[model samples]
Target chain A: MKALRYLALSIAAVLFLVPFYLVVRNGLVSEAEISAASWTFLPSSVRWENFAELFSDPAVPLVRSMVNSLVVAVLQTLGQLLLCSLAGYGLARIPYRYSGVMFYFVVATLMIPAAVTFVPTFVVVSTLGWVSDLRGLVIPGLFSGFTAFLFRQYFLNFPRELEEAARIDGLGHWGTFWRVVVPNSRGFFAALGVIAFVTSWNQFLWPLVIAQDQESWTVQVALSTFLTAQSINVHELFLAAAVSITPLVIVFVAMQRWLVRGVAETGIKE
Target chain B: MSHARAFWLFVGPFAAGLLVFVYVPIGWSVLLSFFDARNTVTPVEFVGLRNYADMLTDGPFLRSLGTFSVFAAFIVPLTFVLALVLALLVSQISFMQAFFRSVFFLPTACSYVVASLVWKLSVFNGLRSGLANTVLSWFGADPVAWTVSTSPPWYWLVLVTLRLWLQLGFYMILFIAGLQRIPPVLYEAAALDGARSWQAFRFVTLPQLRTTSVAVLLLLLIGAYQAFDEFYNVLGTDRGYPPFARPPLIYLYYTALGSGGQDFGHGSAGAVILTVLIVGVTLLQGRVVRR
Candidate 1:
């Protein structure tokens, strides 16, 4: 039984990692070998220049794009965490009339498809003169209904005695939230933080719509440019893709524990 | 602070964001659907249902709706069954469960654009040099234009399969969570009663996973309706060939923001219609789940 389980898991793991392997291998191989009938798992001759070529390529601003992605990811994650936690804490802790109504309104936003909002959001961003700005990319994403919902659910399960004790000590609402509540919810925060980071990092459509300037293009947009460029360099394009995704893969590995917990919690609840 | 005051304070920022970012946009879009909005910065003139009238008479919009319905009809069931089977298989494996789970979940982490691009360039490349064609050549079969061709509907199958590959892992994880919640003793008792593996799953697992199955179905339906990136990336705005594979959202996107031209009014109508369909489907699914 144990051996069977291990075999099944091993097969699953291989299947999952095969795409990553293909991507990395394609990145390393020379352009000639890529179109060949059969290419070895390990490249016969490593093309280390592919990495440098990705940055130096005049058409695509690979380095600028990476920095743009990093900035969006960091800003969106921080803002989402703060806003979501505050709203979630209120929903979980405060007993007030119409709270349920407000909560439902938040949940309703989750159902609104991005396609429905895309053009109008474009209008809003354009009107605000934020069309090619990093602020446009990060600010809208900073507050997510899904994140608020997740945090609310997590906070609902948190113990209330600490907040009560803080209150008894004459701690104000803000003081209680910062000194008492925030400290106790580290795990929940971490879990939500990883999710927020991943979502912001992998975001494509809004960023694509808003960031018209190449200087502010995210990595995904930059990679798309490579794919769609007038002169398509398959080797360089694959290498750029591999490079762009490397950070995300690393982050996923690092935060696998928190991600798993978040997924499991959300799945079970839903 | 009073409870009402505190609640208002707490909800203020988030509410404002949601109103501006979500509700206001939706309201504006709905309003725009009644207007004759053009690319110019000038004020939009109210045409009051002319866009909807145009949509009613529009052949391409109807075709897109029909194509999208067909895509969703095929994709939802295919994804659900694949996810359910994979979930059941992975759940029964006790050792290295986390490894399996992470492996399945990895695809979910990839953006649709990335996955679609990867499949387009490398996996489903039309030329003989493509991965799929190369693999088929070893089997003494001819190369297939997986994305380029639309005849025989095999191209649609490739698109659906790619979507399934990307989405199966997510639903599988959800199903696995649902499966884990079922008490082991129930399975053990069923086994003692001489229930076979398939029988045990049918009688025990299937009934227990009803709510999750409904949720998964609803999610899949919404996702299928909202599928723009995959279709947009794979099939460019122009229907390059005879049998076009453009989904509704793609059509909406093209109508609204395509390089050819922008017709915000018609596009808004399309979006509104699509949103209503999705919401209706979701609500019906929710009712079914509750029952």
Candidate 2:
């Protein structure tokens, strides 16, 4: 039984890992080698120059898109963290009129699937003159209802004494949040931040539609153009795929603990 | 600051963003659904449910919903079983738990576009050099055109496997958390009552996992309905999108945005219809699960 278990695991693990390995292997090889009828498990020669070739290609804007993706993801993460955290804290802790109505409104957004609003949201962004601009890419996605919901759920469980102590020490609500609440909830913030950042980075249809011009494309949008471009370079495409996945892999490796924890919290909750 | 002031100060921006970006668009979409808005958001003519009627009766659009049903029917159960089985298996092992967990989860970091590229160009590509064909050649079998052939509909294999690789691990993590919450004492009690391991699992573990299972199924259902990236990336070609597997989003996108005509009325109508379907299904499923 134990042996069978290990075999199942090892097989699934290999299946999961093969595509990643292929991306790396094909990335560093020549185009002829990639298209060769006889398959090779490894590249004969490492072509580090594919990176340079990819970046230098006029049609493929690798560096600019990567920068755009980074900027968009970072700004989106920070925006979600600040806006959702504040909203969540208020919903959980503050006593005020219209609290129920406000909370209901936020939660209702979660039920309205993205497909329903895809075109109209595009219309909204376009009407605002954000089409083909980073603002189009960043602003619409800045405040997620799901993120706020998660934060509100997390804050409801927070110890009241911490805020009370901060209050007694002469911290106002804003001061208490910035000084005490924010500092204490680093893990939750990091977990949600990782989610928001990865989501923004991996976003496809929105970026594909909104960033119409080549200059404003995200890495995902850029990688897509490779497939449909006039000239397809298999090796360079693989290399580009490899390059695109690098930042996310790094983030996942570094922040996986918090991510797992965050997943757990969401799963077991009512 | 006073409590009222603090509440507004904190939640105000989020509420405003939600109203502008979410609720208003929904209202606009509903309004657009009733108008003769073609190639423009502002319409001089109001059509009054003609758009909604057109979408409901449109063969391709309705078939797109059927495609969603097929996708959801396959993916929801497959992912649930695989993820649950993986969670059970991973939780049983003591050594290198974290390694196995991370190995499975690492793919969650990958984007659908990147994965689709790899799958299309190398893995499932129709050439003899493609990974699947290469393996088949070794086995003395003919190479199959995965994405191209619609008779056998081999594209489903490409689509489903890609989604499985990208998503299975994340759900496994959810099940793992659910598994961890199951008390070992329950298993002990079952064992003391002379129940076998399978029986213990059926009674103790499965019942304990009800909450997580429901949540996972709900999420998987919603996700299956929302799928677009892999379909657009993998099946798409210079010729055009194949008719067999275009989900509602792709259909709506082509109607409203992809085509130069920009038939916003029909698209908005389809969107509203799809939204109602999704919410209705979700609510129905919730009721069923509760029962």
Candidate 3:
């Protein structure tokens, strides 16, 4: 019975790992090898330059897309961290008349799926002349109610004595938040930061719609173009997929514990 | 500053963003649904309920709803059972637990577009070199067009497997969290009461995981309704969107953006319809869960 369980898990693990393996194998191999009728588990020779070739490809503009993705993800994450945290802290800590209503309002926004607002949001962005611009990509996604809710839940449990101590030491609300709360809540921030960054990096549909030109496309959008653009090199497509996910894979591995805890908190804490 | 003043100072940016980005769009969408705002964003003609009526009666739009329902029926239960089983399996094992957990959860980090690309091009591509076809070749079978041939609807396999691979781990993590929340004392009590392992899981474990299961199920349902990225990537081509498996979002995408028709009225109408369905289902589920 014990052996059976291990075997089952091992099989499942292999199944999960195969796509990544195939990606790497095909990514590093020649286009001819990728299109070869005979299947090889591993490439005879791994070409490290396929990624460089992908970057050099004129049609893809992957480097620009990567930069756009990094900019968008970093700005969006930082913005969400600052904005959501402040809102979350306010909603949790401050005694205000409309606080309850505001909290519900944020929660209501969470329930409204992006599909419902996708078109009108486009219209709003275009009306603001943000089409094919970073503002369109970055600004709209900067504040997420889900992240705010997470922060609100986190801050509610934060020790009040520290804030009181800061208050007594001639600190205002802003000072207390910066001096007392922000420093101590690094773990929570890091967890949410990683989540936000990964989410922004992986965002496809919005970027696909907003970033019309190749110059403004995010990595996901750039990758999608490969699907329709039949002239693109096959192995380069695999390489691009591999390269696009590398940052996220690193973040996922490095922040594994926090990511798991954060996800768990999102589910179980509610 | 006063508490209220400080609160606004802190939350003002988020409030402004939420209002501008979320609420305004929703309001605008409702308004657009009532007008014939085609080839332009500005309101052209007052169509009243014409857009809504047209969207409701549209064959493709109705088919998209049916598509989501079929997808939800399969995905929700499949993910729940698989994730629960995975959680249980992982929880029981003492050695290499973290290793297995990470391996399973790793794909959650991958984007849907990249996953769809890999699935379409590498895994299930019609070429004999493709992984699925290669495996078939080993069994002396002909290379079958996974996405191209709709007769057998083998495309569902590609879609389901890709989704399962990407999402199973995340749900599995949630299940693990849920399982961990089930106290050891409950299991011990069940054991003292002469319950078998399966019986303990059936009664104690299942009952303890009620909230988590409800949350997971609700999330899965929402995820199903909001399914766009994978479907759009895997099946959508330069030729046009595939006739089969077009979810509402995709249909709306075609109506509003992809088709170049810019039928904002009908698109917004469809969006409102979808929102109503999602919100209604969520509230209904909430009531059921609370009971």
Candidate 4:
């Protein structure tokens, strides 16, 4: 029975590992080796030069897209963290008359489907002459109601004594937030940051529409241009995908503990 | 500062961003749906209900919805079953649990676009050299035209497998969380009665996971309706995607932006319709699931 369990698990594990294997193995081989009408489960020889070719290909510079993705990801993450945390703190902590109404409104916005906003958001961006620009790609997504809701939920459980202590020390709302609340909430902040960064970095459709210019394309958008029937080469495409997802894979492996917690906190509530 | 002043100061940035980006666009979408708009928001003609009427009558848009319905039907159940099985299996194991959990979830971290492309041109590529075809070769089967063959929809095998591979891990974790919340004592009680494995699962595990299963199923249904990235990334070309591969979102995008012409009026109407479907289904499902 124990052996049977292990065998079942091993089968499941192998099924899951196929894609990872294809990415790593096929990525390291040449185009001829991949398209030879025979399955090569293992690479004959590691040809790391496919990635070099991908990077140096003037059509879609993998390096430029990575940097572009980094800029968007970092700015958007920082922006959401700052903005959502402020709103969440205000809605959660401040003794304002309208906080309850405001909190309800903010959380209610979370239910609005992304499809409704897709076109009009584009209209607004194009009207603002933000087409093919970083502002167009990054700004519209800088604040999310769901992220703010997570922060609000977290802050509600935060110890009130910290705020009172800050008040005793002559700290105002902003001061209390910066000095006391933030100092103790590094785990939540890291979770939010990692989640926000991964999301922004991996965003495909929004970037695909907004960043059509080669100079402005995010990594996923750049990787997508290779899928056009003419340019579709499995070897380079796999290498590019392997390259594009490497950072996220690294981030996931490193902070998966917190990432899982963040996903749970957001998902189970819904 | 006073309460009102501090409140505004704290919430000002988020409120400004949300109003300008989120609220205004949504409000504008409603108004845009009424007019004969094009690439620009400047409505070319005042055509109230015509845009809506046109889409309602359009065969392609309706077909796209049907296609998406099939996708949703297949995906929601497939993911629910697969995620639950993996979760149940993982939950029982004690060794290297976190390692296995992360391995399953690692794909969820992968971008959908990347995953889809990898599945299409690499694994399920129509060529005999493709992984799926190569695997079949050993079974004395032939290479399959996956994306191109809409007659029997070999593309569905591509779509469903990629979607499952991409999404199963995340939902599995949710199920695991749900599974853990089922206290061990219930199982002990079941064991006390000498209940068999199937009986224990049926009595103890199934009933306890009701809320999580509903949440999982509901989320999967909603997500299936929003399908675009995979279909577009995998099946689409520089010109356009095949009819069979088009979901409502992809269909609407092409209607709005395809070189045929940018018909934001019709597109926004479709968007409005899609939004209504999402909200209505969510409300209906939430009521059902919660009750």
Candidate 5:
């Protein structure tokens, strides 16, 4: 029985990893090598020039795009963590008259697809002249309804006695929030942070709409432009893709523990 | 902190962003649906249901709706079954659970635009160089233009397969999480009571995952309705023209942004109707799922 389960899981793993394998394998093969045959499971030789040429592509500033992605992801995650935690803490802990209404207002945005707001958001950003700016990219994403919902649900189970004891010590709301609540909710905050970072890094549509020029483009957008350029350079394009997703894969691995906990928590609740 | 002041401070940022970025835009778009808003930034003249009326009579718009409904009908069930099967298999394993979970979930992190582009260029590249076609050729079948071809029989299958590959992992994670919540004691008890593996799953696992199943179904339905990036990136307006590959949301995007003269009013009307349908269906599903 144990051997059967192991064999089944190994097959599942291979199936899941096939796409990533294809990306890496294709990235190493030259144009001539790729077009010679339909598809090869292994490449005859690794073309390291693809990665070198990907960095040198003049149409896309790959390094700049990576910087833009990192800046946006970091800033957005930090802002969301603070704002969502505060709002979630209030709704979960504080006794406010309109708490339920406020919670509903936040959660309602989850249902409102981003596609519905695309046109107007473009108008608003254009009016502010924040197009091609990182602020435009990060600010709108900071207050995530999904993160707020997640944090609130997790905070609901937080022990009330701890906060009551802190209240007895005369710590004000801000003080209690910063020192007590946040310290205790580190796991939840870290979980939410990973999610925020991943979404911001991988986000395409909003960035594509706002960032008209290569200078402001995120990594994903830059990689996409490389793919759609008139001269189809599959080798370099695949290399760019591999490079673009490397940070995400690294982050996923580093935060695997928190991610699993977050998924388990979020899922069991719903 | 006082209730009123603290409440505002806590909820103010979220409310402002939500109202301006979400609710207000929706409301404004609904209002714009009644106007003859052109591409210019000037004030739009109110046409008072002309756009909606036009849509009612528009053959392509109606056809797009039918195409979207058919796509949703096929993709949602196919994805659900695949995800459920994968989840069941992964959950039964005693070790390597997290490794399998991460492998499946990693694709969800990939951008839809990139995925669609890869599918178009590399996977389904319509020539001898294409991956899918090459595999089919091994079976002595000719290569088919997966994206360009809009024949009724093939179009639906191609669209569903693309969507299924992109989406199955995310739902699979949800199912795996749902599976974990089922107590092991139930299974052990079932085994002692002479319940077989399939019987235990049917009796214990299925019922425990009822909420998750409902959530996944509703999410998939709403997601299918709103799908645009894949269709836009993979099958552009160039190929499979007129009525076929155009889902309703894609139609709205094309009318508003495509070269069809940029009638914002008509597009907004389409968006408004799509939003209403989604909201209504989601609410109905919510009630059903909760029950």
Candidate 6:
């Protein structure tokens, strides 16, 4: 029985790790080595120059896309932090007559498929001439219903003592929020930030449409163009994909627990 | 300021984004289904459901839906079974539980784009050097065209395997989380009642996981509908794609945004149809699960 269990795990682990090993191994080698009809498990030589080549390649603009990805990811994460936290504060704490309706409206956004909104949003953004601009990629995605819902749930269960003590000290709503709630919720912010940053960094379809120019292309968009445009550079493509996911893997490794817990917490109560 | 007015201050930016990005677009999509929306401007021609009528009967679009159904049919069960089995296996181990969980969950951090590249370029590459072909050669079988072959099901094999590898980890974690929430004393009591392992699992574990199963099922269905990145990266190269591998989004993409200018009306109608299908499935799942 123990052997059977071990065997199953070994198979699953091998299946999971083989592609990863291949991508990493093939990424560090020459293009010729990768495209050959047959190949070695390990390269005869390592080529750090492949990455330098990708960065220096004038046609693809790898470094610029990396910077673009960082901007989109970081900016989107910050925007969501501010907006969702504030909205969540209002909906969870401040008792307004219409807060229930407002909460429902926000929650309802989660159900709508993004495809349903793609054409009109594209038209609107194009009409505003946000095509080939960062605003088109970043602004449309800043506000997430899921993140807002997360913040709302988090704040709903928060103890009132902190807010009450702040109120007793003569602070108003905004003051209490800025001074108290934000500080207390730093861990949640970090967790959500990592997740949001990864999502924004990985965005492909929307960025593919709007980041029409080479200057504004995010990493994923640029990587896709590398594959489809004229010639396919097998090694470069593998290397670029490896490059794109490296940041996410780092963030996940460093904060895997919080990320997992955050996602699990998103589940609606039974 | 009034309390209500202050509330709006907190809600303003998010509400504005939601309106511009989601609500307005959805509203416009519904309207566009009725009119000839050839461009961003107001449609000059009011076709009165001609766009909907045309797309519904369109062979390629309808066939794309059918293809999606088959793809989902393969992936949903495959992922479900594999995830459950892995979850069960991992949860039984006392050592390195966290390590196993983290390794499995690692792929979930990778984008669908990267996953597709890994699967397509390295694993399922059409050349004899491709990993799949290399393995087949050991068995004395001819190198099969994994992505291009339409005779049998090499393309489906490529799609299904990549998707399962990418997603199985995520669902496994979710299932493990669900399983861990079930108390052990219940199983002990079942054992005392002369129940075997299989019987205990059937009555105790299965019943406990109902909510998780329903949630997982709904999420899987919706995600299967949105299978674009992997599909586009793997099979979609140029203007032409094999009919067998086309999903609804890819078909609609070409129909609406192809090089020879776009027909926005047809695209919006198709998008609306897909949205309705997703919403319908979720509602049906909710009803069934509730029962």
List-wise, what DockQ does each model earn?
A: 0.50, 0.74, 0.74, 0.67, 0.48, 0.59
Expressed as tens digits, the lDDT of each residue in B1-291 for candidate 3 is: 998899999888899999999888878889989999988887899999999989888798999999999888888898889999899999999999999999999998889998898888888989987888988988999999998888898888888888899999999999998888788999999999999999998999999999998899988888888888989889988787878998888888889997568899998899888888888987888788778
Report model 1's TM-score to 2 decimal places: 0.93
lDDT tens digits, residues B1-291, model 4? Answer: 787888999887898888888777777777888998876776677888998898899788899989888998889989999899889888888887776788788887788888887787778878898888888998999889987887787888888999999889889989998988999999999999999999999999999998888878877877888788888887888776776668888898788867688888888888888877776877787688667
- In model 3, the Cα lDDT at residue B120 comes to 88
Q: What does candidate 6's lDDT look like per residue over A239-258, in tens digits?
A: 87788888888988898977
Candidate 2: what's its TM-score on chain B? 0.97
Root-mean-square deviation of Cα positions for candidate 5 versus the true structure, in angstroms: 2.5
lDDT of candidate 6 at residue A81, scale 0 to 100: 86
Candidate 6 C-alpha lDDT tens digits along B190-286:
9999999899989999899988887887778777887777788888665555666778888877677766577788888888888878768767776
Candidate 2 Cα deviation (angstroms), residue B125: 0.6
lDDT of each: 0.77, 0.87, 0.88, 0.84, 0.75, 0.81
- C-alpha TM-scores of all predictions: 0.93, 0.98, 0.97, 0.96, 0.92, 0.95
Which is superior by TM-score, 4 or 6? 4
* Two-way lDDT contest, 3 vs 5, winner: 3
Order of candidates by DockQ, top first?
Answer: 2, 3, 4, 6, 1, 5
Q: Which ten residues in a row have the lowest lDDT in candidate 3 chain A?
A: A261-270
User: What DockQ does candidate 3 have relative to the true complex?
Assistant: 0.74
lDDT of 1 at B232: 59
Which regions in candidate 5 have their CA more than 4 angstroms from the true location? A1-8, A264-269, B152-158, B237-243, B259-261
Q: After superposition, how far is residue B235 of candidate 5 from its true place, in Å?
A: 1.8
Residue by residue across B120-230, what tens digits does model 1's lDDT show?
777787778777787788899998888777576666866786787777887887888788789999999999999998899899999999878877877787778767666
The 10-residue segment with the lowest total lDDT in model 4 chain A: A108-117
Kindly list the interface RMSD, in angstroms, of each predicted candidate in the order they appear. Answer: 2.7, 1.4, 1.4, 1.6, 2.7, 2.0
Ranking by lDDT: 3, 2, 4, 6, 1, 5
What TM-score results for chain B in every one of the models? 0.92, 0.97, 0.97, 0.95, 0.92, 0.95
